[model samples]
Target chain A: MGTALNPSYFMVLSAALFAIGLYGALSRKNAIAVLISIEIMLTAVNINLVAINKFLTPEAFIGQIFAIFVITVAAAEVGLGLAIIIAIYRNRHTVDLDDFNWMKW
Target chain B: MHFDFSLLTTELSMFILGLATFVLGLVVPSRSRRGIGAFALFGLLAVLGLTVLNWDQQGVLLNGMYLVDRYAMFFKILCLSTAILVIFGSLRYVNEHLGNHFEYYSTIVFATLGMMVIASAGDFISLYLGIELMTISFIILVAFRSQDGKSLEAGIKYLLQAGLSSAVILYGFSLIYAATGTIVILEVAHATLQGQASPLLIAGMVMLVAGLGFKVSAVPFHMWSPDVYEGAPTPVTAFLAVGSKAVSFAALLRLFVAGLAGVHQQWDILVAVLAALSMIIGNLVAIPQTNIKRLLAYSSIAQAGYLLVGLVTASPAGIKAVMFYSFLYVFATVGAFTVVAVVYNKIKSDEIADYAGLVQRAPLAAAVMLICLLSMAGIPPLAGFVGKFYLFSTVVSGYLWLVYLGLIMSMISVYYYLRVVLVMFRDDPKDPAPIEMGSAANITLIITMVATIFLGIYPNPLSEVANSAAISFFLK
Candidate 1:
């Protein structure tokens, strides 16, 4: 049953998700939404890691461990992001990306 | 399964020192936290001492997850001194504007520890963790002045971009993992050569360059730097410019020149293009910067471009040039920023125009800034000149075009750097009062200024150390 779907299918799905996530990350106006997009992209990376681990390298669990590390690091990053976002919001009253431009080139 | 305890001594000491500084920061009263900077300075000095004591203790530890070698030691020394100088520069500003946040001292220590780890990272896991540790610490440090909107904005921008780049780098790592079926860097190098280039591997390598390129602030990835430098406290900006950028180069040199030697042909051109773009864009953008910090940011970006030229050589001399330049860079960049912080503390301005008559107000600072900027402009009789000469000479035979572009752009850079110098010496002061700076800041400026000139006049000792470090990595 597990062999019913090909690994390339998962790869394609991961690529599509990554493209969407990257587009949203760059284009989104809201800071939180941009963060969510970054998370989505990270999730896509996890799928690639896990799929490759399960299908290609069954002998080694390196990919699984890497996936775990990524998840943990991403959690910490989100926590830092939220703290900074709150700080910005308290001072400026908005998390809009455009509104955050006080210091220009 | 042999673990080398001696090989881990410097890093272990640094880790303990970071924890101690953090606890000390927490226990001390807010007003008394002024002493925390001194504590951090002592801790960093201890770590530097350990690094020197263990300089020749080279081995692989944690099953090759970490390496203790001359390459790492050279960078460790550079990073530690950069942190110490930054702390020295920060003492007065932290006491005055930052309200005795002892945590400021600890975060920098932690950041220095992270950079040291990056310098020693022998595998992908350690590399990723090291980079994340440094970047996260920098984010918090950048936002240390939480009440300041500009600082908060800089922190958020750093967070968003750094997070995105981390994700991208991870994805690249995953691809490399899939292609090679290993995360150990040395193993990956062997596997990549045996299997040669696949589309997945090629894409992975490109993403790796792009991600690390962001860390080094190469053009197209350098947009965050000017704003972040302008907003962050001046001392942290110096740390970001010198320590963070140098660590990025350390990791990059390890990964590319050592871990991916087989694929050098594939990525060398990519690095060359990035170097050219960074040189052209960084210098051109710097010409128009009125904010002194932003100008330094752009100048640092241009410096990164110059450093990247060494990467194009793909030889032992190239690495030596990079290591030597990184050492010289710490003195020039930190020295300049210390003076900037001193002035900002006095005048509450970062505008270049406001720096008019700085020589009359603070002759020593003006002089230090002059030497540092002159060094950065690659003028003769300064460390920057010798560093650039070494870098260009190494690459001239192989990448003459890059050398030409670097020489021309650095010439262009002299214009902006000298503009600041002219403003300092030529213009009249609006406030006719001498700028007062703490003795520690003055000491840091004097030491860095002396080191810059000494290194310029006498390059043999540092050049030899850099060459040894370079030889150790490429030989393996």
Candidate 2:
């Protein structure tokens, strides 16, 4: 049974997910895209947490608990944050960040 | 579960009080904004009192990630009091210039709660949660006006950097967990102490610093401050400048100094380098600023550099100096901006030239402004001076050059500060309004003035408390 899972495989998955999220977060201008990137990044964390918890130390259940909490937080964060974004979009008529120049001279 | 009713009461009350402001905002249907301002002040004062009452009480709560203790209690009181002062001080301005004053006060309360959580966070879970809560709230607060493009821009800019920093931080978190198999800061600290310092762990630490650096607006990561300050509403900018920075620094102090105390030598050089860069770039760049907000933005960044001196040492005195500097930084910046808020409200501009003859129109505001800027310049008999003296010496005890560079930058700040004073006193106001100091704003002015000068002259009481608090974690 111990023959199936290796730590590096999980590490590679987490690393790829983190990089993709990093790219999306930095390149995307839309608020939603940026948030999606944040979600991806968060999932990347959970992946690592779960992977390490299962493979590295069975005694340390702390990382598993942390992963669960992070997921819940991410969900809640996106929900509240998106609602605000929608409100801003409704008032301003555009979600494009460039159009969000209310303070600019 | 023995319910710590009194302990839970403090946190719950903040949330309830803030929500009340929002609810009352909708239900009251009264145009008298003063009533809401007073309520907000009273709520914050109550929170402050609770923080003091439980100041020395230490206990673990919420899965041990969250802590309620003297250390956290001290900063809880600080954040609440600062919020109260800022809210009261800007009461009239909010009614006149800013819309949604109730929402504004409520957001400050929520943001303060987020900061308090960070102050007491005992583990990485709470730390990240607290920081994110504070950050997201600020993004909303910065763009509260929604229509202002600068506010929106500031919000988006902060979001962009903050987003990247979050990833970096999370990556570091994951990597650290990968290396040590734990995320609890105390547990991780224990692991690192016995384990070999691998290159991987150090790399993660570097990434972690990158993320934290952006939050604190330290050099190589402070590209956002000038624009953000220039664009966001004055009061929100004040919060970003002081409130956010203080909270982040509080968390950083705990994380780096306490959780990772065993590894101070390893990180000292890295942080010292960042400190030098901040002092050099923050001061020199500030030299050319014509806009008062932008100048202060750079000034604060430089002040961040000076405060890093205290971090470099990580001694009892260093921690004490750091906390003192943060308090001074928050109050002085808020105080300075309080007058700036008034000037901006009246003149509708933040250029230094607009403050010319501010003394004629708003003598009290001008006087407060003078004291704040003088304090910032580290002039004698001002809290800023005392804060800087202790902070720089903390670095100088070993790294003599840090103090030397700090002194040069202090001289550099003197020029801009005086330029501001000259404008305030020397020139006549163009179409000055009969200077109206709202009672709240006037009181904030007086509080900041007295606190800055009084603490400057005799810092014994505060210094003693802060010193003990700084070393409190280790000695226990």
Candidate 3:
């Protein structure tokens, strides 16, 4: 064999992507940006699942199946998120997380 | 593998009911929409009856993807009863404030379906799907009053926070699957028992605790609740408090006790810390809230902390305590929020001061609110006290510190609860006119109050049921 690809490399990449997405989700001011960051986080999770399925659990496709379900559910989540964002924007004319503070303690 | 479709009678019936309600809402004229609420109510009652009838039946479906046992049936009963009571309480509110009564009722049914699904989930995929089903329906319901800015804001807030938490949970599930090479919860337990503890499994377990902690509104992850509670409609808030929280606990128990039992030593202390913090922060923060809904939100956070004590023990007795507390909690919370919804309808305000001298205006509502709040405070001869006694007793040996903290927090909780009672009973009403209540609201209030008091006085029946449920959980 010329070279071997280690599953650890994919795990590291997935972890890095997850960390970046988490940071963006917490720090982004725009509602849409926060949603995008959530999508990125979900994508990272999917990557992790698929990589694990390919390496450790090659006989069982459970991880890949789970990733598919995640993708489908993530789509539905984003759809609802965008609809709510639009509804709020229509009322308040802003998508800034800062402006959404109408009811705080 | 053969599928036993009959095992799914309750869920199928509930789904059909939701579909029927939605279709009827479309076909019927707007003038007759009020009857649909009653339609949904009776349908839920039927489903509740079915679930209770199937209480003793036990089986696993699809190689343990769906489970039908007394434990799952117990939660199914809780979720169904909560939905029924909420619908009965909110009938007038939905007809008056919300434009689409059918959608409101149907979404509640769908949300109940989601809770039932979570209760029976044997695999991670079903659990996630059930949670999303419930959550997505709630998102629509929260924003039902689309014209109101506050409602819209609450919907967005719930959507974002809930989405983020779900992603976190899914990531944890992925990690757990990677560690065990199996997604079945029991198989994961077996794998953990056979293999040495690895960083991958430990990290996954911690993530599971954190994500489920958010769902249960434990201290550090409880920031989303007060805002969502205050901004959403009162009935939705009540459903969130009773139905959503109870079912999340069910999921948490299933995942932690069933799937992660091999690593119980690793997580027990972490859970104990969460329980302590929730009891402290949830009670202290509640004292300053002026909105009755927000106050209830914080009290519920405290209640979540008390419920977590049972999980910390990870024993059959602990499971029984959680189930018992959850059952009584439904009545007290629904009773309080029914009064809130009715009062808000009349006064058009949620500020605590607006409730001054409520005893003079609506004696029954005021009395029910007082009793419910007291029950939540764990006062003697109340359901909450018995519930707390059971929970705290389970940890007497290892978690004695938690019991002390719980006692002190219960005392602190009483102060805030009594503040509301004082405003309702002692102070003068701003408007001296008596508040009128619909017959439906009256019935709901009376049932809840009776249940709360009766359960406190005679806790045997429900506790026995919970005992059997807990036994079934371990038997599997």
Best by TM-score: 3
- How far is each candidate from the true structure, as Cα RMSD in Å? 1.2, 2.5, 0.9
Q: Which candidate's lDDT is highest?
A: 3
Using DockQ as the measure, which candidate wins? 3
Model 1: pairs clashing at backbone N, Cα or C within 3 Å = none
Among residues 3 or more apart in sequence or in different chains, the pairs in candidate 2 whose N, CA or C atoms overlap within 3 Å are A101-B149, A102-B148, A102-B149, A103-B148, A103-B149, A103-B150, A104-B149, A104-B150
Each predicted complex: what DockQ? Answer: 0.83, 0.43, 0.86
**What is the Cα-based TM-score of model 1?**
0.98
Docking quality tier of model 2: acceptable
lDDT of 1 by residue, B1-53 (tens): 66668787887888888888889878877667777778889888888988888
lDDT for every model?
Answer: 0.90, 0.80, 0.92
- Quote the lDDT for B332 in model 3: 99
- Chain B TM-scores per candidate, in order, are 0.99, 0.96, 0.99
Q: How accurate is candidate 1 locally (lDDT)?
A: 0.90
lDDT agreement of model 3 with the native: 0.92
